[model samples]
Target chain A: TQLLEQSPQFLSIQEGENLTVYCNSSSVFSSLQWYRQEPGEGPVLLVTVVTGGEVKKLKRLTFQFGDARKDSSLHITAAQPGDTGLYLCAGVATGNQFYFGTGTSLTVIP
Target chain B: DARVTQTPRHKVTEMGQEVTMRCQPILGHNTVFWYRQTMMQGLELLAYFRNRAPLDDSGMPKDRFSAEMPDATLATLKIQPSEPRDSAVYFCASGLVRGVGTDTQYFGPGTRLTVL
Candidate 1:
């Protein structure tokens, strides 16, 4: 089974603070996706990183794919209370198999 | 925006009863997946279907749980003789697969099930 470990399982920060969540794996992936889930709702896709050593920015969020495609990261700049949610990273391997991360719960206090 | 819809947003039932959850995927999608989420296990894929044909169901408990996509737009998951341990949120996701590349899966709101 492929494992996607996420760091800082729980995070609480004041509004406007910057934070970064990391997703790491020993096995290489074809693509990695980041999602944000609010209470009582399913996860919503945030972004997908396909190429190695690639970086994509969406507003205040930046996502990076590792050179080996075995890791990824999500950095949030000037986070607001609306950013509070459970962040999950899912890696897709060969045969379109998906492995989800342990998840990071972020709470941005206003 | 296209969205997946699920029925019985919440369900509370007694142990040993049968429970069924339904999902309606967005139009034009060709793949559907069933997943279960619990506090301990997070999210796990229970089954997957492509073009209404089941592709994988390795993550499901063969004896008590069953999943099926009868058509392109509808999917269902059933649990018979449910147990308290079966209580959790069940989600259905749909996407269009292009070759072997990664596909973006859109998930439903999920059905929160509780077995007493």
Candidate 2:
């Protein structure tokens, strides 16, 4: 089974701080996706990176796929209170099955 | 905006009881998935269907857990003789396509089940 492990399972930072979360896997993935989920709601897709060494930026959020397609990272710049939530990284294998990471719970204080 | 819908946002039942959760995928979506999330396990895929046909259910327990897509619009997950370990948030997601390259899944507000 393909497994994705996320580091820094929980993070607490002040507003305007920058933080990075890592997702690593031993298997190559066809695509990787990042999602942010608020309490009481389902996860919402933030970005999808399909190519190795690809970087996609959405406002203050930056996502990077590893050069070997075995890892990914999410960096948030100037995070605000609204950014406090659980962040998840999922990888899609050759068969289209998705494997999710352990997740990182962020608490952005005001 | 199109979204997946799930019934009974919250449910509380005793052990050994039957638990059923339903989902309605977004219109035009051909794929649907069921996931379970808990404080310990995080998120785990239980089953998924494509074109109203079950594609994979290896992650689900064969004995007590059953997943079915009775129609294109509705999917159900049933657990018989549920145990306390079954208490978790069950999420239903839908997607437009089936492949790994471009399929984007849209998730529904999860059904929180508590088996006491």
Candidate 3:
């Protein structure tokens, strides 16, 4: 049973502040994905990082995969009120099984 | 934009009752998954199907939980003699997995079930 742990389970910051969330696992995964889920809605895919040391940017959000594929990070630049939501990292292991992180609930105060 | 659909957005049932949740996968998708979300456990995959076949269900409680994909478009998760602890939001996702880990699953709105 593979497990993914996320840091800062709850985050509350003022608008325009920058924040970073981390996801770590002991097991190596084939790929990792970041998702943002708002209230009353299912999670929406943010970005998928496949290779080690890969980095993908989606506007103000930047994602990075660990060199060993055992960890990942999401960094939001100049965060705004609309960027507040639950941030989750999902790692895909062998056999197509996905292990989700504990989740980080972010609140950007305006 | 094609999206997965689920029925009974909200359900409140008494304990020991049978609860059934349904999902309709997006068109052209062969992979389907069922997940349960709670504050404690976050999001846990209960079961998944590939090409309308059950692939893995080890995450689900075998004693009282059952999941089946009757057809390409529909998947169902049922719980018999439901308990209060079973309250959670159940989500259904569909994807087209081509390689080892290239699939991007699209999730449904989820069914919020509260067992009393």
Candidate 4:
């Protein structure tokens, strides 16, 4: 079984702060995806990184895939109240199976 | 925007009861998945189907848990003799690809089940 371990299970920070969440695993993945889920709703896809050492940016969010494809990170800059949500990282292996991360709940207060 | 739809947003039932959750995938999606979420376990994939065929169900308990896709648009997850530990949010997601590679999944609101 493959497992993705996420760091900083809970995070609280004031507005304008910068934060980075990490997800690591021992197994290799064909693709990695980042999602943000608000309360009372299912997760929404933020980005998908398929290549090693890949970097993608969406406004204030920057996502990176590890050089070895065993890790990924999501960095948020100038966090605001709108950035608060549960962030999840999922890895897709050779099979159709997806392994989800431990999840990181972020709260940005104004 | 097309999205996955799940029925029975919330359900409360006693132990040993039979519980069923249904999902309607997006119009063109061919893959459907069921996941259980809890504080301790995070999100676990119970089962997934592709083109109305079972792909993998290793994460599901064979005795009490059953997942099936009756058609390309409908998928169901059933639990017989449900236990207290089954109280969690069950999510149904669908995607456009068969599996693997870069298929993006769209998730439904999820059905929250409480077994007492």
Q: Give the number of the best model, judged by DockQ.
A: 4
Provide the lDDT at B22 for model 3: 97
Q: In candidate 2, how many clashes are counted?
A: 0
lDDT, residue A27, candidate 1: 87
Model 3 C-alpha lDDT per residue in residues A41-92, reported as the tens digit of each score: 9999999999999999999999999999999999999889999899999999
Structure candidate 4, residue pairs in collision: none
* Residue-level lDDT tens digits of model 1 in B70-96: 777789999998999999999999999
For model 1 chain B, the run of ten residues with the poorest summed lDDT: B66-75
**Alpha-carbon lDDT, every model:** 0.93, 0.93, 0.94, 0.93
Estimate, for each residue in A14-109, the C-alpha lDDT of model 2 and write its tens digit.
Answer: 999999999999989999999999999999999999999999999999999999999999999999999999999999886578899999999999
Candidate 2 residue A72 C-alpha distance from true site, Å:
0.5
Q: Each candidate's chain B TM-score?
A: 0.97, 0.95, 0.97, 0.96
- Per-residue C-alpha lDDT of model 4 across residues B1-116, encoded as one tens digit per residue: 78899999999999999999999999988889999999999999999888888899999999999998878889999999899999999999998885446898899999999999
Question: Model 1's lDDT to the true fold?
Answer: 0.93
Error of 3 at B15 (Å): 0.2
TM-score to native of every candidate shown = 0.97, 0.97, 0.98, 0.97
Over B39-100, each residue of candidate 2 has an lDDT whose tens digit, in order, gives: 89998999978889888999999999999998888999999989999999999999988443
Lowest summed lDDT across 10 adjacent residues in model 2 chain B is found at: B96-105
Docking class of 4: high
Candidate 3 global lDDT: 0.94
Weakest ten-residue segment in model 4 chain B by summed lDDT: B96-105
